[model samples]
Target chain A: MFNFEITALGNMFFGLTVLVFVSLFFVPNKHRSVTLYSLLFASLACIFYASDLITLFIGWEIMGWSSYFLIAKTADKQTLQKYIVFNIGGAFTLLGAIILIYGACGSFVYSELDFSAVPSGQVTAITILLLLTLFVKSGIMPFHYWVVDSYSQSNDLFSAVLSAIISKTGVFAFILIFFQIITVQYLQTPILEVVAWLGVLTSIIATFKAINEDEAKRLLAYSSIAQVGYIVTILSIMGSLSLEAALYHTVIHTFVKLLLFINVAAIIYVSKQHRFSTLGGLLYKYPLNFILLVVGIISLAGMPPLGGFSSKFLIYTALLEEHKGLLLAAVLFSSASAFLYCYKLVYGIYLGQPTNPKTEAYPRIPLRFYVPQILGAVILITLGTIPGVIVPMFNGILGSVGFEPVLYRGVFVLGSDFASFNGGVVIGAFGLIFVLILLFFVRLKNRSVKPKDRLDISYCGEVPRADVNLHYGYGMGRELSRIGLIKMILSRSSHALWQRVSTLFGDLSGITQKLYTLSAQNMGLVIFAFFTILLYMGVK
Target chain B: MQKGFVAYNNEQKSLEAETEGIKNSQTLIQKAMNWFSARSMFVVAYGTGCGAIEMPPVFTSRYDIERLGVVGVATPRQADIMIVSGYCSLKTLRRVIRTYEQMSEPKYVIALGSCTINGGMYWDSYNTIKKLEEYIGVDMYVAGCMPRPEALIEGFVKLQESIRNNTIQPGYVKYREDYAYYQANQEKLLGKETQPVYEEDYAGMNLS
Candidate 1:
């Protein structure tokens, strides 16, 4: 039987997917088949619009397979294997959870589930399985081994879809299941707290990884992981404010990634360079593209007079409401460090002197590329100027999901009981100051001269030869390793963390022995008494 | 050979003599601009020899040249003044020329110590250039074997007075008009082009 229903959360996600798909028309897909691409999109729709567990699973699997095929075209054997193994493993866990739910409830339909009949222990097991699946899909750490390889190795445009659209499906699934179907009251608070910490930790680690990466796409891939980590962290709070913040971030991140990826794609289109060391000083060469990238980065960093700040403001307020001071501190620390990578992304690509001489003659970007960038840029600016415009939509989602609507009022000004700011005033002030400075400089009698040659920079009176490693994109995050705590975070991979979990199981019996010894004097008697009791039990 | 800047300076001075100090032949706006430029000087002092040792005492809290509005900047492009601090060797002369060319117009140069004036210690050495003037224009010279920080301060004060009063020829104007002469001298000594040189009056000098 086919049962289809629509919800406010699904509609928002589906809308974003459509916006992403609209940009793809500009990109010429030369792949072996339009069939695979269509399948991917159709499956995405299925997942977003699915009414029951079965329908969702069917869509999820199709999306997975189709994307694997798409990525297989560009990615190497090892990357493909990594992609399939992790995704298949996640898919199996999802299937296992669905089967268990069906067995327990005797139905797969959304409205038909009766958790009252299910055993509490079985429900906890179900929760673990479901969380594991979501964690893998969203690239939460200790379960995020496959994300970076696939996103960076995939074709440029598809990687945008992977980050901006697909990764968010995991988030959609989370709300669809936890907020609507299962609800959070059944869940233990300790589980959610651990999830929140996992998310923030993921972001902090992924940020450092992003900065350490040299290849452009790989760095963006790491950045994508870090951003999704923030959403997951905030979502775990399960408050209306947290949900609004997560949704706002989701919307902003979609447009920001679309803008950045398309901008990078356009750069790669002309320059044929992928590494930051090879791509520098494109600011003048592609002025419009550079400005768009700057806009994207400004939003990415959550600065004021940009849409990013609005969501970040909401996220912090939500955390503060919960009195999650330690978690908020960690989240803030990660976000502050994020500025370094954001700067690296911009400076590595656009600002510095071009490492290659041929970069000067790189071809003009196609008009099609600007279509998505302009669309993204306009939306971002509008959101920054009038962030309150989308609140009613968010309020509608919250209402449909059975929660209280937040107190954000009006289009130009965002006001709540806790915090408020006028977007128009922030933008107006910024514009006025910029104009004043520009006018002052332009009216000066003594004009500032730029030397005709790019190599005219003073280098302690010595001229730099053409081959010097001027752009240190590879070395951007290397300094962080010198710090003690960061060094520990940077050295361990997700695989290492998982490996430790297995080792923990092997040490369980050994842990029992240590558990019995409370003090140094008791330790000697405890060990002797334990051995005697074991020997007496063995004889009996 | 004072045709370019010094002659220009005299024309303005005579015009000022008639206006007599109150108006001083300059518009109020022009006078204001001159006053601002003289008050804030960013210096790029290239330390090629012994005089380099004396700059720290001048710059640090002990002497604090910042009160006089003469601050040291790292790059030539940001600097309004360049001090050829001591003896200019053949190798050092090339960089100094390159840096001088990079600085914008309204720039001045101070050739420090007797070494730059007449090559005090390195005078008889093969690599040293004796007179700083032939290679590039010298706006003011603080004369000593290793000029005292006080002497250097005096040189800056004198330069600032000339800048504020609009009386003396700034070196950049002279370099622009007589670039060919400087380039020819540089090419004869260094045996290479130090920087990009556009077409100008040759000031044809026989290098040999």
Candidate 2:
């Protein structure tokens, strides 16, 4: 029998991920009822619940293969290849670290491992390997090449699952291994500092990449990476507040992505279009979906009156408290730049003039699509209105993990030792102002004049013909590439680095193949020569 | 025939007299509402021709139209006024009509330049419509080959006064009353496929 222990951190993530996975039941995917997806969910549960390295690794492998097959159902060969390659690479790195830990500790149980008793050098080596695995899964830059392709190419609903839940497994593993087992105090400070910088840098670069992407899901994929980057950065701080901030962000990101990806998936289902350039003027046709997307983006942009703001506020406060001025500045820059992409996501699909003439003829979105979006929106709104409701949960998790509980009390108010705010007041003030403005607008005697034709837009005195391209979606973010810093960032490609590595591997494989292909007598001579040299050196 | 014509003229005159009397009897609340609408005019900046060149300067640092509570809005749903700032080619006329109709009630159209009034130099051109009022309502016209920013500002001020005093029938009111006429003209030029049938009006009719 395998030992299984449940912690607050793992239980919360597992519950939320499974909840989202289950809520996706309404989405009528071809693979919706498939056993593989359930198996994937089950394996993730196992990983979350595992008390020992052996059981964790077994669950991790199951998760990798199950998701691979699930993605293989829809994705092309190349995408599948990329997914398998990167994920297997991560799994191997994880296995290496686990084996090393077992070798050193003489036990596979997480609680049995004591890194303080191990040599400092071996501890550093194990930590690096574990970090590598986490970095690959979480998609920190340079190692993030496969993320965009895998995310963009996966099944629409599965893409949401992949982003919202699966990626956070890496964060879960990080907490379990680093904070719980190894303990942060024993980790090298210099290496952790580098990890912090890597996190912020990844967000900055990923934000620019997201802005330039034309495909809606790909843009979202990059946005997901950037968001996770923030989580990684805050986690690197290794403080109680920072841990709370990380957990808060984890919950916020999951809901925001679930809502947004499902919203985009709905649009894609209706219009049969995935590119922003082809999808526009959808708001009137899908008002409910559009509103849900707006809620999602508002939260995603970390604006006030939404749950995104609370987590963002905590993260900034944590950074400020630590006096990480430079890191804080970079994070602020990334957050500010996020507004552009958030606007693009909405405007690309909903706000602008219709691009395709046949867009109006598209079928109505099914009610099933709204299920996940509404769930996400409700959770976001509730969290926004009463952030303190979740704080106690986080505090319990922190206590289990040997961190201080956040100094917050009351149902709607969230506070730290340094600063705090009442979420209810924020929501109340915003609602009052919104209602007042809406009432004033309604009370005005002005009547609405409906346009007879979609083409009835002002184009001077001249009329825009049917052939005219009125959609501004594609053009909205094009100018961002002209900015100095953004231009440099956009001009570079991580693909080149990956390509060079592949070519080097290809050449090395070729050289080894040639050696193996040599005649048996030549191979025997080479082997004897090698042994003789080894034996002579040993005698010397 | 002559007696009938004379009777019709008399009836028209009496109707005008009644409307004039009603206009003069406006209450203080109505006056204040007009003032409020006038003070905060959201303009849908539709640049149709050469006159559009002058608008950017007016709205920017040089002229600063913001001082007058005039703001530029992106969509017609939020706008109170549509500025038709140049020649009305047939293609542009279609869009202008659409943009005009999209605006909410109490909306105003400020037609700028000689091109909008009489097609300017494009009068003989095959594509440009010579008169803009035939297709849609025109509340005010600022005349120039290309109106200067100051002249455009003056036109806005005059339009504001007319709105505040209820001195003239607004264009949107005329549009609602004579929609059939406008639709006929629009269809004649742009073809019947140019616009969709109004859902509200067609709901009761069993066209199928």
Candidate 3:
């Protein structure tokens, strides 16, 4: 029998993200995609509404298989193998935790679970197993080997959905299982503290990886990992304000990724180029797309007058309120370094000299591509201008999850007991300054002279050969690799450990295969002798 | 001596007549624009040859060009003046032409060294052009094997004065009015495929 629960937490996430699922219909994908998307949508619904562990497990399996098949449609053999292996491993861990919970409680329903009656050892085991599943699904550090490949190799539009909506399921599960079911009082260990540091570390490493990336989508994939890392870090704090901040960030990250990924997709569609070296000076051709991307990056960099800044401000304040100074410092470092990659994203595709002569001859972007971008941009702006609009909704979700409500002063103002600010004032001030500057520029008597050709660049007195590359997009972050810590990080790969483990398992299985090489009669005799000894011991 | 003096006097009288015509036609707004343009010169230093070695001294501490409100910019879009230092070979001329066209309106060109004036020691060479003005307009020429930093600075002062008094038409205006003449000359030297037809009207050519 199917068991479902209507809760505010589930409604809040599902309500916002269902649009992302619907947007797939508007995008023109070549693969036979409708079935897989529908399967994904249905399974997500099942997981979101499930009131019992059994239903949740079933939905999780369906989501895994459908997404695997969808990715397999276009992904290479290696990427597909990584995706399947990691996801299947995560599923096995989830199954183990559910079995442990069922054995302990003698019930599968959420209402019947009693952590207090369970042994502390069993509780820790269950929590660890569940944490493993969540970590794998969310692509946390040391377990994020499969993420970059799967994200970059998938169909471009689906990649956006994977980063934005699907990744949040891990956050959703953490809130549900850890906060609502096990409760913080039962944790008894500092596992969450370890998780917080790991989250920050993942962000730091991933930011550098993002900076070093040459491929556009791969860079975005790394950025997605970094953003999710922050959410995981905030969730680890286990306070009401931190919980609110996590949810706020989840919503903002979703919209920001949607806008950015779709924007890049449009560029890729038009230019038929993915490497930064091949694309440049597209701003004049697609002014609207460029503006939308600028908006996306501004929000992503956590600058003022955007929704991203509001959530980021909340995250910082939450850390400050908890007196987590070093952790806050780490988070701040990652945020500051993120600007380089953000600028690279814009400059690689939009600004500077055009590298390929054919770039100017590329056809216009399809109208359908703009639909999702425009939608995401509109929502982001609304959230930026009036961030307080989502506070009441978040507070409702918090209440359903058994957390105290956050303080609310007005419709436009957001704050905790520590600090508060009005979104309207920030937006107003930014707009006023922007308008004044624009007016001053317009009134200036110095007219801008248009270049006669793309080759018309100041190259000293020497004329540049036609074959020379003027684009510095790829070279911008190449020097970061020379820094000591960044060099160490870039030199090492997490995949090496996973490869070693697999090799060890292969060797063990080979030893086991040697026993099967014996004749059938010899194998039967060996089993008979083993059973006789076991029976003798039992009788004694 | 009497005949040569008479001819020189006639040339001087005609030059004065031209200056009077320009002064009478100048508007107040044009005068103000000239003043502002002369005051703030953003130079795009396109180092074409060996003379580029001397430019570092002019911009850096030895010359301190910034004290006169002349700053170096990286891109052509923001530049008001381009300094083509040294001799330009056929290969370099392609880029120089592109850079010159890329610059914004009211742009001036300052060609330095004897090479740009007439190819310097590279005169009669197969690859280098003797006259730089045929390919693009040149406003002022600092004549030397390699112009000294002080001489370069002096050339800039003279160019600024010409801009301020509305006494001379900037080269970019001529490039706009008679682009075909320059284009034909550039094509004759650089082959037809050297530059792509840009998507804008230049003089009479509908490139789009």
Candidate 4:
């Protein structure tokens, strides 16, 4: 059956995709193809609008393989293998779920499928399979072995697209299938709790890993995983308010990641440095880019008066509504610790002393690089400034799907039964206080004498000569690795574990291939023997 | 002589006049700025000699120099004063010049002990610089073989008073007005670079 339609969820994603694609337009990449990118955009649209499982599955595989080729342009053989194997494995699981649904209800269309007819055991299998696909696509942990290498190794512009848009396909798929199609009653509460804990734990571990990383893109890749982890956690709550929280966080995260990846791209473009140790003192050299990066990190860290904090607030309130006290405490702990990596990101590139004298000659960031960052900053601030406006839109999203708006009361306040605050007053107060402090500092003295040179630091009665690596970028987070639990978390390699898994699968395939290499008579004898053994067991 | 030096001298003289005019006028804003800058002193936490041992007691709860609004900062960028805690060997002298230059303007130096004043016990030593002022500016001096924390505190208080009252030309200003004299003296002892050269230059280019 061919089926297609549009819903509020589709519209939100369409708008986001447009925003991302426009920003992606400004990025320069040698491997970029207009035709291929258009194919990707069209396939995503198909997935968003498809009303049938087969149509959705077709779109999903197309998106997967197309992005694989895109990543293949820059990635080495190992990275390419990881990318394809993990993505195709995810696709296969999705296909399994679809096949199960068809066999149970005998329908591929969402409106025609009757889930009640399916046995409880079969339904749980479908849920697990669907969740597996979604986790792999979303780069959720245990399934996230492919994400870091692919994101970091991909071409600079493509990395932005990967983090900002491609990874969110799983989130959209989860909302569409789990919320719209499947009734939540079939899912066990314990399973949802496990998922929620998995998400929060992934975030905590990723934050520490980000701090430990020296490569700029790798750090951002870990940061992307961590931010997406929050969305996954909130969605596991599966309430109407929680749905709103997930969508809200998704919007904020998409913009934040887009801004951050592009900013890093600009840095890479000029300085030609990948590791934080090689990059420093570019703050003044590229002041606008630095400011934009700070804006991105502020939002990424979920600080107040940025759009990041707004979504984070919604997530907390949604959890509180469910009385997930312990889960909320863990979420709070992760958010607090994220500040360390955020500081590390800024300090490594911008704040410290420049180790290279040639940083003075680094080219200015092109005007096009500013386009997306400024757009992102403007939107985030506007969202933060008018916090009440988006709530009604989230409410409208529920109404569009014929879902009841049981809880939403007003524009600013959330969770009437639980704690709520007027967001307008909070934002206004913060804005006013910020202005006052800024004015006080600016009105003071204006006698800042520049140092003789960059190397003129207080080095215990000796000058740091030009050749010494004065930049603290490499050593900034080496302290946290000394701590007990974080050290354990950072030291464990998921990639190595997955490597053993791949090797085992390789050996299994080798044995099967040897069975086929036998002559025709041998193959026939093997089949006959297998059937005879099966028949004897049946008779018994 | 280069006309550039004459032009620089003229600019420097007018700048000094402007500072003097500001000092004489002493508007409420200027006074407020001076008072705050003098009251909240950030001493660069570096030590060259034996007097460094006496610093912890002053900074910590023992002598509690923090009561007088003087606190030690980790870097020269944020520091208002650098305490040359003891005698400077040629090695330490290079660092002192670098640190003093790095400090932001309206900065001062406190030469601690007789070592910095006239080389003290290191007067006859080959490596020691006899007078610290030849290499960098010294705003105040506490001239004991090993000055106690109380004497160091007194030196800080007196320096703060002089800064607040505008009663003396600050050493930072003097350094700025007469940089050539200091650099020449430093080069005489420290060779042409006036910076510690290591690591990068150690390998002979003839390695190939």
Once fitted onto the true fold, the runs of candidate 3 whose alpha carbons sit more than 4 angstroms away are: A33-36, A103-106, A117-119, A265-288, A349-366, A407-409, A461-476, A524-540, B1-16, B21-33, B40-102, B109-138, B141-159, B169-208
Q: How do the candidates rank by DockQ, highest first?
A: 1, 3, 4, 2
lDDT of candidate 3 over A279-336, digit per residue (tens): 8889899999999999899888888788888889889999999999999999999999
- Residue A21 CA error for candidate 4 (Å)? 1.7
Chain B TM-score for each model?
0.83, 0.85, 0.86, 0.82
Q: Please give each candidate's TM-score.
A: 0.88, 0.84, 0.86, 0.86
What would the per-residue lDDT of candidate 1 be over residues A218-291, giving only the tens digit for each residue? 88888888888999999999998899889999999999999998888888889889889889889988899999
At residue A161, candidate 1 shows an lDDT of 87
Q: Can you tell me which runs of candidate 1 are displaced by over 4 Å? A: A495-540, B1-23, B197-208
Residue B60 displacement in candidate 3 (angstroms): 5.4
Off by over 4 Å in 2: A520-540, B1-20, B32-208
How far off is residue B149 in model 4, in Å?
A: 6.1
lDDT of candidate 2 at residue B97, scale 0 to 100: 80
Candidate structures ordered by TM-score, highest first: 1, 3, 4, 2
RMSD of 2: 6.1
Name the runs in model 4 displaced over 4 angstroms.
A355-358, A406-428, A516-540, B1-46, B51-74, B77-81, B104-108, B144-179, B195-208
The models' CA-based lDDT, in order, is 0.83, 0.85, 0.84, 0.82
Task: DockQ each candidate and list the results.
Answer: 0.32, 0.20, 0.26, 0.24
For model 4, how does the per-residue alpha-carbon lDDT over B30-133 read when each residue is reduced to its tens digit? 68777998889999956899989888998999999888899988888788899888988877777787787777767888888888777899989999988887
- In angstroms, how far off is A243's CA in candidate 2? 0.9
